[model samples]
Target chain A: AQTVTQSQPEMSVQEAETVTLSCTYDTSESNYYLFWYKQPPSRQMILVIRQEAYKQQNATENRFSVNFQKAAKSFSLKISDSQLGDTAMYFCAFSASGTYKYIFGTGTRLKVLA
Target chain B: DTAVSQTPKYLVTQMGNDKSIKCEQNLGHDTMYWYKQDSKKFLKIMFSYNNKELIINETVPNRFSPKSPDKAHLNLHINSLELGDSAVYFCASSPRGGANVLTFGAGSRLTVL
Candidate 1:
């Protein structure tokens, strides 16, 4: 069984600043994928970024990027130049390749203050 | 167009009642999943279906049933709803054979009284 952990329950960052939400996972599977998702008050969850465990280079999507340290079992999401729209519940998820289940962390509530 | 859609965005019901939430995905993905997000925002997988075949059924109660009529549709039915059943239910789909990128629907918030 794989477990994802998000140590921070809540986080706040000033507008236009950067914020990093930490995530760690315990998985015995060697082939897996990590993801970050954002759910706003509207309740629509959207994918932020994803990183493949086999890829040493972290994944970056516009302002959202991931610092994936496979050896350390850490995959943190970094939001650069955060905006008000970035305020949402961020979840870190893990899925083993060829498996149908996704293990999610107890999301972090992020607030972007203006 | 919505990639993944679930009906009854908000469901309010009484205890001991039975309710069902329908989900459909237009992404033509091979796998669909049901997840429950509790009040504390902890998300956990409840069930998964691949091409209408039951794959992953987590440690959910027997009162919660999932039906997949096809590869693109998965419906969740709950019997004897309880206060603990009040939570946000999310439906997601992914191309199972490819990169496991899941696209989720706008969750269905179920409130039991």
Candidate 2:
């Protein structure tokens, strides 16, 4: 069974600083995709970033980026210049090719302190 | 316009009662999915439908049935709901072949008393 793991249960960072949330997965399939989602107090799930296993280059979206290490089965998300609006619960998800099902990890509560 | 929409965002019902939640996506996507988020924030895939065809049905209980009348809509009907059924259910959709990126709707929170 493919599983995504987020070791940190809670984390906080000061505004304007950078924070990295760690994620690791165990999967036998070589072809897969990884994602990071954010859920705020409004209870809406928002896609922050995505990474493909075949691509060696990490994925970046504005202030959000991912350090995807396929060999180590790790995909960590980094939020640069964090703001109070960036505070939310972060989730790591994994989806293997041909399997439409997405396995999600227990979320990490992230708080940005001003 | 909302890309994806779900009705009855908040539902509170007694145990043993039956309820239904409806979802519709206007993204012209061919695939739709249902996910359940527990109190601990663990998401579990419950079902998947592609163009009104049932493709993936996880180990959900028989009391839960998903119906896709068209490619754009998927509805979940639960019979004899239990206390454990209290959670937020999300409806999501993605384009065919680009299944990795999903557009999710505002979830429906079900509270079984």
Interface RMSD (Cα, Å) for model 1? 1.7
Error of 1 at A4 (Å): 0.6
**Deviation (Å) of A108 in candidate 2:** 0.6
**How big is the positional error of residue B42 in model 1, measured in Å on the Cα after superposition?**
0.7
Q: Write down the lDDT of every candidate, Cα atoms only.
A: 0.93, 0.93
Best by DockQ: 1
- Candidate 2 residue lDDT tens string, B1-113: 99989989999999999999999999999989999999999999999998999989999999999999999999999999999999999999988533368888999999999
lDDT of 2 by residue, A1-114 (tens): 998999999999999999999999999998888999999988889999989899999999999999998889999999999999999999999988777788899999999999
Clashing pairs in 2: none
DockQ of each: 0.65, 0.58
Q: B30, model 2: CA deviation in Å?
A: 0.9
